[model samples]
Target: MSLQHFMDTYALKLLQAIFVHLGYVVLCVAIGSAIALVLAVLLTRIPRFSKLIMPFLSILQTIPGIVFIGILYLYTGMRPITVMIALSVYAIFPVLKNAYSGILHVDEKYKEAAKGCGMSSWQTLFYVELPLATPSIFTGIRMTVIYLVSWTVLAAMIGQGGLGEFIYRGVGTNDNRLILMGAVPAAVMAIGLGALLDKLQKKLTPRGIRLQEQSESGQSSGKGGI
Candidate 1:
């Protein structure tokens, strides 16, 4: 069913829901990425912590998103903050794994080079390691944002008012158009946001890497011509 009829009736409400849904996603991603990045950096500095923390986080991630959100709703009474907390926890794992893997997998030679240049531990991390690891880190962020957008629908389950409101209402009423109203915009948002982030990933990637990739592509073309 086309969303036009439903949209015509509730255009303002739907627009508000979209913005609210987006706000939840933004909050969750911002908080999740900050915490994940910090934990990733800490784990890298003390490798043994990864042994314990990684397993714990993996276990937490294993719990279904709805289950965790439901549990939080029971305790917190349908508050938006509870929904945000649940979303943040769900959003954290991708970036955490990416940051840990990205930093840890950085070439040892680069570390040695940084040290040889008299860079301090902190300086080496920020200047040399993070720049090289940026592409991977951005990959994590891209995934997290997309995940959060999908997950934000759950906010409606708690009466916090998001696109999920229409979705759940539509489900209860057996209205296909209402369901599409919620689902279609969400899918579009996720795809559009993912594309934007992909562009950002390229831009944020180190210039050296970008140039090398371009040079390699040129070389490959030259070889093909030969």
Candidate 2:
């Protein structure tokens, strides 16, 4: 088919698919981040269980996305909720691991200062630990967003609309153009979203940390020059 002809036929469908794909990405990331953050905080309070729970979550992450979605579909009957649940579960691991690690790694001095200021446990967590952990948490969020861009395509497997519809259809008919139509957009979406998250990470990071990093980088460059 001619390029113009293809566009005329599929442009509206493509737009719809992009919106559907974006909706899934946003909802899954939001739900997954909330769940992960809460769990990470709770685990911080009870460190002993983390050894067991973290490994279990890592195992869940090992499950292939297609297989997980397929299993959920079997049990949940091909519903949109099935896809959402699978995607959300998949989204949990990276954020959970990073957030847990980030909070744990916060310098003892900082925590001591917070305590010296008469901050409560909740206050220390909110006003100090989480802010310092923002960069790491945002890294997990970016990973989740990029993965969801591609993973949301699985929604098409059950007839919920997304760019994956074009990809799967193209594969069935051996049409490379159709596959590209789906794939190129998803790649672009991932890149664009990842960049946006990078910018957000910078904004959310503490100014002191950013300045320290910049200073360290400059000193390293000067040493190399010498």
The estimated TM-scores of all candidates read 0.92, 0.94
Q: Write the per-residue lDDT of candidate 1 for residues 21-84, one digit (tens) a residue.
A: 9899888998999999999989998899999999999999999888999999888887888998
Overall local distance difference test of candidate 1: 0.90
Candidate 2 residues 162-214, lDDT tens each?
A: 89999999999999999999999999999999999999888879999888779
Which pairs of residues have clashing backbones in candidate 2?
A: none
Q: Once model 2 is optimally superposed onto the true structure by TM-score, how far is the C-alpha of residue 82 displaced, in angstroms?
A: 0.7
Using lDDT, give the best candidate's number.
2
Minimal lDDT window, size 10, model 1: 1-10
Model 2 stretches with alpha carbons more than 4 Å out: 221-226
